[model samples]
Target: MDIGILLLGVAVLIGAVVVSATGGDRKIARLDRRLARVEQKLDAIAANLGVDLPEPELATVKALLAEGKKIQAVRAYREATGADLKEAADAVERLGG
Candidate 1:
């Protein structure tokens, strides 16, 4: 009887620990997602402030490169996104690739 009681106690302890860890993990995940949304909003605000930030969508670059307007595409990317030449070229390559 004593051994059974002890086993039960240990099982309960382990279950509590597992629950606590899971709860903490869920909380962290929620906070991370919340922060991401806030960051996206801040990026939009920065773009509105004339920062010329890059858009998240790559369809425009892909289409431009596919049309063989490489130079115009690169220039448009640089002007609209304010990316350096190397960065703009890399992005274009990746988009087209």
Candidate 2:
């Protein structure tokens, strides 16, 4: 009976941990969506105002591109801009890197 109680307690603890983790993940996803929306709005406002958003100056990315290391340039761009794989690749290509 004691072992059975211990097992039940362990199961409850594990279940609680899983629930907490899932909730945290949902919150993070929601925040990411909100941030993306805000970024888009800001970009639109800047465009309407004829303001060209300054590009991030990443020396490492530029250096890698200059060295003909396209893959490394993409990686560096992603690190610097927090961009995903496709975005980084496109940005690098646009830069003639």
Best by lDDT: 2
Per-residue lDDT over 1-97 for candidate 2, one digit per residue giving the tens place of the 0 to 100 score: 9999999999999999999999999999999999999999999999999999677878998899899999999999999899999999999999887
Candidate 2 error regions (>4 Å): 64-97
Which portions of model 1 miss their true places by more than 4 Å?
A: 52-97
Ten residues in sequence with the least summed lDDT for candidate 2: 53-62
For model 2, the local distance difference test gives 0.94
Q: Write the per-residue lDDT of candidate 1 for residues 1-97, one digit (tens) a residue.
A: 9999999999999999999999999999999999999999998998889887555565666678889988778877887678999888887877673
lDDT of each: 0.83, 0.94
lDDT (C-alpha) at residue 83 in model 1: 92
RMSD, every candidate, angstroms? 10.0, 5.2
Best by TM-score: 2
